[model samples]
Target chain A: MKRRSAIALVGLTLALAACDNMANQARRNPYELPYGSQENWPVMPLATAVARDEPLKPPSPPPVTMALLERGRQRFDINCSPCHGRLGEGDGMIVQRGFPRPPSYNIDRLRNVPSQHFYDVITHGYGIMYSYADRVEPTDRWAVAAYIRALQASASASLADVPPDKQKALQ
Target chain B: MAIFTPRANLFMNAALIGAVLLGACLLLAIRVVPVIGYNTQERFAPEQPIPFSHKHHVSGLGLDCRYCHTKVETSSSAGMPSTAICMTCHSQVWRNAAMLAPDRQSLAENIPLRWNRVYTLPDYVFFDHSIHIAKGVGCTECHGPIGDMDLTWKARTLYMSWCLSCHRDPAPHLRPRDQVTTPDWRRTPSTPSGEALMADYHVHTENLSDCGVCHR
Candidate 1:
């Protein structure tokens, strides 16, 4: 009987120890895990001067390509169209819902600003807008900026801006 | 003198005990089985600050999961949409409806809406949305037909063993990266088989069940 009881005790201890493994343990929020973004990761140097009193332009505008613009359009529709409106008229569904109205991109103030300003706002956020740094990847930010610039130009464009070959179609 | 014979009394007591045991067993089946079974919850939809319908937004309006849960692809949590996101259209479309009063109040006070979480994991189970998304797991795999849900409930049992079943063999649930957010996506003959997807996504089964994979 003594031997049998000892064996049972050993078995129970083994079972309890197995249950004590890390998988069964409770973890806290913000767990220290691998593969997530880390603060120690290298940061890329700013490609454009920080915007202050004077507006700074990007070293060069991202090469305008159909694919880039398409990507920009999709990203903008997902991220910016909520507040900026699908056409960047500052009449997005959210704006209608009673959020603070952002200035229309078609406005002269926004149209005159360099593409870098848009990127800065997206990266750092402006006014009541939250920074989309985590949501919008850097390349996509540039694409969105480029797309916004196109939207601004198109908003105010005249028949003169249309290609001469395509002008007849409009007429 | 007695109301019944002793044998009859014994038989009656036995029957009473048997009925009690049967009732206990039924109670256990109702309460315990759902906790253990896969995708077997009774679909209890909790009340929320707003009656947000996933079906209306996702299926009717054709909004992508990423439109509101913006960080699903990049962060640990599938972050909730801010009140501003809700008002973007609500301010114009349903301007004065009583249903939108909470949203209007939240925006006016500049306070974040306290949305009740439907699906939550225990603190011990560390799940990352980005990793699962990058690994090609569809949103519907665990969320369970969210686009059809009028009011979202915890769809899957989310038991550890259920998680292990997928972690051990994930190919069957894997899909093309583009279709991860496509809730209605299903495997077709032309689509790569689970084994091919497993190879393409490089989902090695060996380390997936390791305690540290989720615990740490």
Candidate 2:
């Protein structure tokens, strides 16, 4: 009888311990779809669909502050640098690995393009490149355009263009 | 005929001693057993389809975590690289490697490759990658030295106590927001003090460990 009672106690504890019902609940993961469910496959919004979160107003592209540039650099490095290269020379790692080269930002054509053009291309991709509207937000798209302009200027910048205090570092 | 035999007294003593030893062992096991590597699943590499190595991709090639996990900044979950992201490089290099056969098949079939979650939190726990990242919690804070891991494994037990320990005193775990995704990031001399970073990130300790913070 003692042995039976001990076994019963063990069974009770095991049963109680095994109930992770509260922890698991009924939550479905964002990406995971359960079998037998009628959930549609997750897909990026088509070009015809609402792509840009906000209207691109020419009057107010967020003032190009240092913060904007910094954000641009970060977002550009993550999203564009793989294909566009760090310096925007179109020789990124992906290109080296055989993805078609994107136009160099230093090129006259790209340099002449307005920030609005850059913002538009990113919103709805250009040429072989797919739309980055999914990854980069609207404001960040402007930031990247501004950074691209900075990259273009740096390509033609001379030693004298550097600020005197910082010139020694470049030397 | 005696009320109690001397031999019975010895047996009683032995039984008492045995019971005390057994109780001590049970107490020790209760404390130690659950935290063992086997029970915790710490450092155990679950089998993956492609045997993708973080060491090869992260350390060897210097790929950023955001290279694939693009939604990490804005979303609760760090997005897994789609098959297209893998094929971006694989289509050019290693075009027909047997290891990447599943990757190609996944793309062709339009089915996502199922990756086993290394640090699956209980559904009740509201862990947001974006919040942790925005608040400057480095990946290595919980993920360990990912660059050195050939096959990713559970670095630490995702036990509630483990989560609360850091949530209670997060200064040590805080880093620069830029370095949040850097694996095995170490503090340099130039790095801000943990307290300074905590202040900069506007982290408040009071609500961090509240049960509602994680358990929703």
Candidate 3:
């Protein structure tokens, strides 16, 4: 009976050990590996060049379109929503306690920023935001930028957003 | 009749060993020697709608390669000298020449010169001329030597294996930014050793072997 009990205990211990190993693996790769620019450039802790003095020239291929915005919305919901929050208010559960609280997308500073500026920030990453270059294609970056604009517009839109005909219908 | 022949047996064994060694060396040489100059001569030949000659334009007139292929440093596709860019010189110089007939035909037909692509990589390989040039990988890193040739063909095999040779470790081919477009650029005294340059640039080799890189 003692030998049988010992054998049972050993089996339980092995099962728990395997469970713990699986839990660790699940925790290690929560998202994709290497989420940003892999270059070993010097990360200036608190670099003062946060805002540019002069305006950046236009983006290489130019501005985002509505079609791009719709595509961007899909990509954002898939990739960004898990951490950035569905509404982009930075209230994602992971961020509420300890994970980096990504800035809200409705902020005027980022909303008014040039599309290419947003593209660069997403591609190269700024602050806690990891670069999405590997996961997102170049054109999709523009799409994401468009979706951010749509989100900003939705958040800020007033009754004035409705046309006069639509206003009459509401009345 | 007088053959107590242990000495003769030893000599025959040595000759057999020598023959095997020679055969192995010859097989290795035959496989390797053909690959040495395979990509160099073919990639530098000239081809265009007008049959423009690098020998006539560059070697004969001593004109710079950059003067025509202006975006070779700045953009990809070497900007495929637009019809307007070509007509800038050809209009004034070769206006009445019989050899210039094809150039006139293309311009009249509104067909851009379908210059045969000489150096091409498989579509899956993302070879950014800008990034490579920016990081100081020279034109000849893949194109061999173009300034001396009169025609163009595939200079490098441009196979994934060829790219991996440099990508796995690009320590022997890095040069300065100015030397990036220089056709005759090679690993010379002034050039930074490829290893030091890759280190300075922080180009990681951990993912260099990843199939997704070249394949996707």
Best by TM-score: 2
Candidate with best DockQ = 2
lDDT of 1 by residue, A103-132 (tens): 998877887888889988987888767777
Query: What are the lDDT scores of the predictions, listed in order?
Result: 0.80, 0.84, 0.64
* Residue A147, candidate 3: alpha-carbon lDDT: 83
Report the CA-based lDDT of candidate 2 relative to the real structure: 0.84
TM-score of 2: 0.83
Residue ranges of candidate 1 with Cα displaced over 4 Å: A1-74, A80-114, A117-138, A146-171, B1-32, B35-42
Off by over 4 Å in 3: A1-171, B1-48, B59-64, B186-190
DockQ of each: 0.17, 0.44, 0.01
Minimal lDDT window, size 10, model 3 chain A: A23-32
What is the fnat value (0 to 1) for candidate 1?
Answer: 0.27
TM-score: model 1, chain A: 0.64
What interface RMSD, in Å and to 1 decimal, does model 1 have?
A: 6.8
For candidate 2, lDDT tens digit of each residue in B1-216? Answer: 898887998999999999999999998799989899999999999999889999987876667888788888788898988887787678667888999999999989887887877777777888888899889998888888988899999999999889989999999888898888777688999999889999998999998888898876
Cα deviation at B123, candidate 3, in Å, is 3.6
Encode model 2's per-residue lDDT on A20-135: one tens digit a residue.
76656677777755533656655446767853445654335889988989989988887888778899999887788677788888777887777899999987887767667666
Find the candidate with the highest lDDT and give its number: 2
